[model samples]
Target: MTAPLSEQQLAEIAAREAAASKGPWLEGARRGNVPTLYRPLTSGDGVSTYPSVLFELTSVYGGPGDMAFIAAAREDVPALLAEVERLAARVTELEAEHPSRFAATPAEVDVYLRSILAEDTYLRYQQAIGSEAVREAMDDATAYRNCDDNASKKQAWRSGIDDALGYVDPDGDVGPYPSNLLCSQHNGFGPCPGYPWCTPSQDDTEPGDPS
Candidate 1:
């Protein structure tokens, strides 16, 4: 009687089969037509378009002092996308080898999965870096939205906040208090707890006030 193939022999067979099955898809992916087994980015808005994540990363206020950091991130985007594509190609190669006559060993799948994850993480890092400038621009554009001169804008902002607060606290009336102001008399530090701002007035010193 013929002996069954050993695990090592089985692994070899699986690898060969996977390689053959994945060749067509791999070729297509090289031309940017990666099959269903490979999807690099869900949104095909093009590389030039700003991703939401990139927008968020650069959205923080840093003034002219942050120019260097933003520039550095923008430089990293291409590098990140390249790495993402590289890993995606590898994943497709591995996945195409699926459903072979021989059972695919767990170790083979694990290595492929790890490669995909590493590339994806690198891509995200690059995108965040790329979006820094766009985010900064967005922040700068809206910088004047809170100025005292822009009373209409400020009122709109306050009204929105109040509406949100009311929605959350339907039983109570919520208004913009001193604690919510941008500058305070306390050296512009923040709202003082001693002030009757967001907190209710304390009449503890009044004798028999609550008895």
Candidate 2:
């Protein structure tokens, strides 16, 4: 029986999980772990605050905001793990009471885990949308949508920050937006260069570049 986690513990677990794994989504939540994302990209060089990982746990905090948002959005990890352990414990108790006919295999557990993971993902996404930065950006773009008949306007609010940041896609009018950081070609150490986050000004666009 694991006791409840303190706030610092929660934050630490969240940081460790975000840097490493998909948190409770992939891991059973019963296991708190680290950067599986770093493996394929490095010689076990360990996880830095890579570009992709920032967007994984939550898309809420970006652009000038620090890594704190990742910690806030990590609620899903513990929440998912609690649900998993509670369900598994119940299943075990039931099987114990009726061993002759009752059983819970790992695959069966996985089926339930998948459903729960989906639900948690959705819940976290909604929370990300409601986050302060995202909500504010959406509000900033709301007028554009209100004035235009374009369907893309409806989505403008979410991606409005890209416009504000002057990071328009190649098609400025309609965008999949552009990344804040580009993979630097001049990385000195020769490895992936940490995919370190950069500013709009630091982007690699040249005059001939489509973007």
Candidate 3:
């Protein structure tokens, strides 16, 4: 005679399948883990508090105001990813068109680097948003989602953000890196820097000009 599978065992099996189906998404969750968003961006006293890997997971899987917001993000992630990818491609194309501009100065290069990195991270995060694992994690019991567990989810979440942040923190309170780049350059806002989650500041008037 054969034995039937228990509900717990069945749930575990389903979870495993979901995670494997979306490797990149799980990776993002693992990197973005944070205990909470109140953490600062510095390291020591009087300094900014650096973002923890756990925060990323909580931000994505964790609902808005203790509610589930993953479903809506799930719907939006594809479009967001597409937008970032297109932006990144445009950056590369523009760089090719104006090689001299990108090679102008260190500050300009820094700006370009930040912009590209931000775009790249945006794409990766969107990939995570579409991941079966994240969706599974969000759809899982509200209690389970809150539990710390292995911290893998959090780490994965940050990884996506870190992909484009360079030396910056993804969920840090310093504002989006792409926006910071714009502020450094144009000194205004309204531009996207061609990436998702990156809002321009009051300084971003002209597009990035390495020259």
Candidate 4:
């Protein structure tokens, strides 16, 4: 039997099909057409000769060609939506067997970071950061949304790494670069190229984790 579709395949197919349904509508809507509905009034009351309210209205409530395309789209959109829904359900089902999308709590991030810091090589650190959970902690702008200020953003990410190592390891040895350094205080510099301010604890062995 043919293999069941992968979650990746299902996600790609669902996205493409959904976009296809919108493509024709966008094409028809963007087609250049400026009829009397959009032109300067030759002679009329204020409503006709005034600002772009009429133009905006006509754009939304499109004229003849738009109505025809929309009528056809109305027929196809429901089926397209239904197919998209079905594919979404299938993707959901298949995805259930995969790893849960990781969202790292502070404690979990700490655990992951500390565990790796104890190791001579940060293999675990690199691997874990690539995980959706740690990525959210370290680098995801959407995940760390309040990081509007540059310093806070830098602190947010740097502190995660530091906190992980700052905690004493199982052997009671603090990580090579513990959080006691207050690396955040070192904000104004050419580059933080030393131990506390900048230390390459985690090195990526493969092509997945961010540099």
Candidate 5:
């Protein structure tokens, strides 16, 4: 996948765009049956004319389409660059507001998900057990899990689950289950307790639980 443009790259593009000739450039009369581009000029009299030739399509392969694209780019590029910068700023603001939505890597996403699971577990345990120590321990575990260094190391089970879910092994090499089958327990209500988020019922056994 193509990496997102960095701020430096965006700034460099903006610099190039700023250095380019001021636009709203116009298509001028064809020269020798070849299309031409011109920058609009206005004198003190306020009469506008396309006297300044910006580009002349002299290449044997060049056509009207090429000339049109080049002329349009003069305006399109700046507008697009401005929009990119604005969106980038908005994304930064949104990431500040909701960091989970902006998880850029698999490891980061895993940590984000795990943190949510931890919070949910904490809340459930607090309600069920009513113990402050359990809550504190859950908080500690969440903080430890969220450390940047531990993100990748903690994701081993993600591959296993993905394999089980047929994401990695769609051919069913990981298990007998078909890729198309959805868990009966996870029907619209929420994820089952066998997974990370749910609380197991008395009849339910957590995945990989020997009991």
Candidate 6:
């Protein structure tokens, strides 16, 4: 497959489009079976005429499809370019807000997985507590949901849940623990509380250790 167009290539295309004559251009009266492009002109009296020829298909190889596309591109290119730029900007904004969504590398994937686990754990804790104060605090802390600091707030919330649930940090790090250990520690029981699939037999490893 061909590589995607870069911002520079897009900008170059935009520049060419801008430099081209303004459109609402049309295929003018054919000259000896050859197609010609004409910019519709409006006189001071408001009469429209196709006297101004913008381009002509002089080559014998050109067809009606080529003429049609070239005529339409005067306006279509700019509109398509605009949509491309808007989508690119939105993707950039999303990447900035939640970079893990676009993670590619193994380490990045691990971080993304950890973040998902942390968020799930944090949400479960909040739901179990069912306290208005805690909910309000979470909302306040993450009010600027698109901001970079929101990530830190999420980490803080996860840490708080870890402390409240008495999670043992086997790795000596304040990040995601193994799912089996998390489930076991969550309810002070061997079986996972919310997750029906997780059982002691399925994960034979001890609470603080992961195989």
> What TM-scores do the predictions have?
0.18, 0.19, 0.20, 0.26, 0.25, 0.29
lDDT (tens digit, per residue) of candidate 6 on 161-184: 545333222333433333323344
User: lDDT per residue, candidate 4, 140-199, as tens digits?
Assistant: 445456556677776776766554443323123332222222122134311223333243
Query: What is each predicted model's overall lDDT from 0 to 1?
Result: 0.39, 0.43, 0.43, 0.43, 0.47, 0.51
Off by over 4 Å in 1: 1-65, 99-211
Error of 5 at 107 (Å): 17
Q: For residues 83-118, could you state the per-residue lDDT of candidate 5 as single tens digits?
A: 778778889898788777554553354345445755
Candidate 4 lands at a TM-score of 0.26
Candidate 3 structure quality by residue, lDDT tens digits, 1-211? 1234456755644454443322123233232453222222344465544545322333433334322223334533554466567767778899888787635653455455556666445434434433534444344434444768667866664554454343332344444333232332323422345333333332343443322
Q: Which regions in candidate 4 have their CA more than 4 angstroms from the true location? A: 1-68, 104-211
Provide the lowest-lDDT 10-residue window in model 1.
Answer: 21-30
RMSD (Å) of each candidate, 1 decimal: 27.7, 31.2, 31.0, 18.0, 18.9, 14.7
Each candidate's number of clashing pairs is 2, 2, 44, 0, 0, 0
* lDDT of prediction 1: 0.39
Candidate 1 lDDT over residue span 35-61, tens digit each: 222212223655433444322122123
**35-148 in candidate 2: lDDT tens per residue?**
221112222455544545432332222222223434445675666588568778889998787664236543344344435654334333323433544556667776775676
Query: What ranking emerges by TM-score with the best candidate at the front?
Result: 6, 4, 5, 3, 2, 1
Cα error of candidate 5 at position 8, Å: 30
Candidate 4 RMSD to the real structure: 18.0
Better of 5 and 6 by lDDT: 6
